[model samples]
Target chain A: MSGSARVLGVLGGMGPLAGATFMQRLTLLTPAERDQDHIPSILWSDPRVPDRTAARLAGGEDPLPWLLRGIAGLEAAGCGAIAIPCNTAHGWFEAMQEATSLPILHIVEAAADELLRLGITNGTVGLMATSGTLAMKLYQGRLAARGYECLVPAEEEMARLVMPAIELVKANRVADSYAPLAEIARRLVERGARAVVLGCTEIPLGIAAGPALPFPVADTIDALARASIAWAKPAG
Target chain B: MSGSARVLGVLGGMGPLAGATFMQRLTLLTPAERDQDHIPSILWSDPRVPDRTAARLAGGEDPLPWLLRGIAGLEAAGCGAIAIPCNTAHGWFEAMQEATSLPILHIVEAAADELLRLGITNGTVGLMATSGTLAMKLYQGRLAARGYECLVPAEEEMARLVMPAIELVKANRVADSYAPLAEIARRLVERGARAVVLGCTEIPLGIAAGPALPFPVADTIDALARASIAWAKPAG
Candidate 1:
């Protein structure tokens, strides 16, 4: 990567809408008086990458090679760093970082860091995401390493509430997501969660930050967007 | 471009949000039941490209080289077709198409084709866009060639209603853009426009397709997105 070029590579399309939402958040987060002041991004939105959740849980094809192709495309285009917005896809983060010298920003790590920044140290954070994300321990492992207790929905709730809500969001029926998601958040709060982390990108699209839930929600997309902005900023 | 590869190159970052929105629309518009079923896209969202409207109207730095670099990046990455989401930047569409053998999809041409598809032939259409788009006669030239009369805001309306609304949208205050734009639509309808073409990408972000406006609105982003989907589809 050239020292003068501050391009951010986005490794996206784990779900195409999540990837695009991340880009939109990045645009809104940047403090730009003019178009030139915003960060330059190389986005390879190849939705052909195999499904992450199905691959983790049900013997679907591995998405690594397709993801690697996207990473290489961005690297070849001279991107200095990379950000992947899909939370479930972080299962391959370490391997992806090893595949390229480009600094890949992890969505889980950013969310964990956000928990620390928000003064929620040593407390329980509720996580709402796909079964694969929980099964892979994407958030649990990171939050545990950071000395924070992670709370998740029980198996019944995961099957009956969380997964269905995520699917609804993927299908673009966001209005139907609010009630089920709010119920899950309320349950997490009853179990002593300080803040609910929207571990899935689709979660934020359906749920708004308001008084309907019992806890403050930390959106992983916003955390990742902030991290990307920081990564693209010029060094003093 | 190779005959086997079905890739879409996006020449974007002329107001990065619009570019991102275009990508999201493309993803939604594609008839994909699974991940790989969607089109492969290479997006170069380089915001440092010189401002198109400013360059056209105020003798500012030219945006063509930066645009060409984006197009070349896509082509080198194995893209078979290219789409640019910016409207004012369409002022250089012919020259850009000449610069590369890759098929370049035109926003105005797409809008005109969409109008015809909607049975809007031989009728007057209203245009709402930036001063640069108007001054360059971007929509009028193409629509006239396609045998349709185009109506633009008068100079006073351009200065008072259209340009300010565009600026507000650029600043991300899209909610405030509704009333003045509705008024413009009504005035254009009174002057004999059968439908309104949202020639600028930002207009759709601000104005919703509803019964409030006197004329039917045609979104250029949707038109371009549809054109891209057609371009990327496998031929029988």
Candidate 2:
């Protein structure tokens, strides 16, 4: 399937609100003269699934079972492929694929490939992602092949710069809550970051590159959505 | 009840893709830290809902039933309120509230409140929504009361300037697709329209104001999201 008629299935609810946010991005990403031009999608929000970080830390509740169930539902509903928007849930990708017959798109891998194709290797990338995702070595491990060096916020930087700002949006605090992230970016720039990777989808919501940013911010969520648009369409 | 722990429900599926995109926005919008800071959300993507245009034309299947089902799910799940990202769905707001005891946030009205507060009334707003949303008078009707003159693209202009460019993103042809919308926007400025609204969420994904536009492109979405942030957590 090129683009016009492909169906997308979302295996989500690593946090329910985030799942909804991904759906919004699809609309923001698609070209529609009306709402109908948007491709149909199936989303299964299973927030009850084990917390992604907890699974990584304690091996408590695994997301693979719920992920498989959601994928099956989407496949039965006729989805062409599956996407999990949660930045952390991607850690279970191997297990998730083993559980489903349909093709599951890998967010980090997609991001790495796009970074490679964009020739973004060798720049100072100040990564902004969930603590779990950052700790998991997702970006570093993937980007290592491309020779791109990844830098994460210091522990104090995460507390002072990142988490509160992201929390503001989670708490529905939008524009005014940007100071913390902005301040963090400023420091990152002071520390010699050439570009900032909005690795967490939520970070891009209220914040974007300003004329005075430490550097340009690459919105990877937008990149993935744009990629999805390409993957779903007919060739020219 | 505030941002600290609010649950938001979404009545969605005007087209499954748009709903999915909106969900991505929610994730992007949040500023959560340890993951627990994220507000819970629920989504219902029912692609079976008749096209909004078709339903308006011949009184086809009313989407109210499905909309209500979604609202009910969120309320049942303990959502404090709801935000439906679909612009056209708001046309049925009356019927939607009839189905739920929970409060629903209206994007247009909420946006209007922000606009009025910004003192931009009587300002010329270049409308960039889908032909269907405009034809249905969803945004135009509400915007009229705010003393704003809404200018739609001329037929040839819309076809040559707007539609094809929008179709490019939907069809997933994004590279160089922006030239058309920017050109059309320049011509609209010559016609004396002051600022563009980026009315449709998807339009922002296509052509947005950087250093290129003739005037300000007020992204109403950016307004809504920013407003939600301040409203959620006012500075002391």
Candidate 3:
């Protein structure tokens, strides 16, 4: 079997579109002049895995076992490392890593690192993600650890704006999601957030470019894609 | 490790976007109300596999070994069946099937089946693909076996329209590709093509849905995605 210099495994299908978005980002991010120069990847898009937010909030089945199986599949396919694009899934990150020796890139950690790299050291970073991600402090804890304050949607805003918006995206009503999500971004900026992190994978799809949302948006999937590329770089 | 009832392995990334598009179509085509109802898939998007067109035409490095490795990776990941999205890569379909005992879905055969289902048994089916696919008679031979005549781009059209359009798509200038490709589609319809198969994965990305081109367009990726879903259905 002729593997590339390195192969990055993608643990995805938290929602199938999000997984596809991650793969598309990988293609867009790479400096490949030709198709053959792009990264080699093995992706396990098993949408059969239980929903992470529902599993955490409503006494649904644990997604860990299914996630572990995905990791195993990637490993079996000879992936050197793995990356999961979903932010809410990181609630079980430690357990998934424990299940396998393969180095798994954390989405929140990658986003936080990207924020610091962009020189946003001391500002309030806004996070717009699934309720489960916010409830578990997925981005909050990671940003706080790096000495950055985090701002999130208020409880009412979450119920009224963020969560429903994510649902709309999952249901393939992406255009309908824009207004509510844009309002959430506006409120976050008003609450003194210097930049916003699209903590949920589907969030980026809803929000479009050009002066609509008046802050720098850091897409977590884009950060993870870059991290995967760096991780796949051959050792010196 | 837990595998789904049936895992369809994707041998992809002859061009990265095409592979992602195939995965997206699988998600779209399934009769799933929730995520878990969708099929599970393992994908090896190894763009590092040498170009199939260059190999066939100009005596470049054979992509067969890299392709075989991808197949092995899929089998190791416990895939019961496999699909390759690239039309040009179908040239090595038999060789890959010989390398693995797992059932592999053929994109050309799936498209041919779709043509019959559409009730276009005796008319000329137009094909728009890379020079390599055209040269190998990839679609022509399969459609002919099924008693359908295949009409490819004329040599002048291949050089002037089809080949350059595919390159523009590969270069991410999809919008620029639309006009030329639509012209080619117009010419094919004028030549008595009852339906046109977007034989190249990149072709569908170029043409838009509107009254510009009037022929029935059968997207090969869509046919392959449906075939994969059928292949993964649990036996009664």
Q: Any idea how many clashes model 1 has? A: 1
Error of 2 at A150 (Å): 1.3
- For each candidate, what's the DockQ? 0.55, 0.16, 0.56
Candidate 1 vs candidate 2, TM-score winner: 1
**Per-candidate TM vs. native?**
0.92, 0.57, 0.90
lDDT of 2 at B79: 61
- Tens digits of per-residue lDDT, candidate 2, B107-207, equal 77766665556566676767776666677777787788777778888777766767667556544454455787777667667777767666655465556
Alpha carbon lDDT at B198, candidate 2: 65
Give stretches of model 3 more than 4 Å off.
Answer: A116-121, A208-214, A233-236, B1-4, B116-121, B208-214, B233-236
lDDT of 3 by residue, A1-236 (tens): 24446888899888777787789788777766567777788778888788888888888888998888888878876788889989999999999889889899999889987787677876797889998998888887678888879898889989988988887666666678898988888888888998899999889878852236766878888999989878876441
Model 3 lDDT on a 0 to 1 scale: 0.83
> Model 2: how far is B220 from its true place, Å?
14
lDDT of 3 at A30: 74
Q: Tens digits of per-residue lDDT for model 1 on B1-236?
A: 12354889988888787888888888777776555667778778988888888899999999888888888888888898899988998898888899899999999999987787777887788998889999899988778888988898999998899888877666666678777777887888889998889888878877763345545778888899999988888461
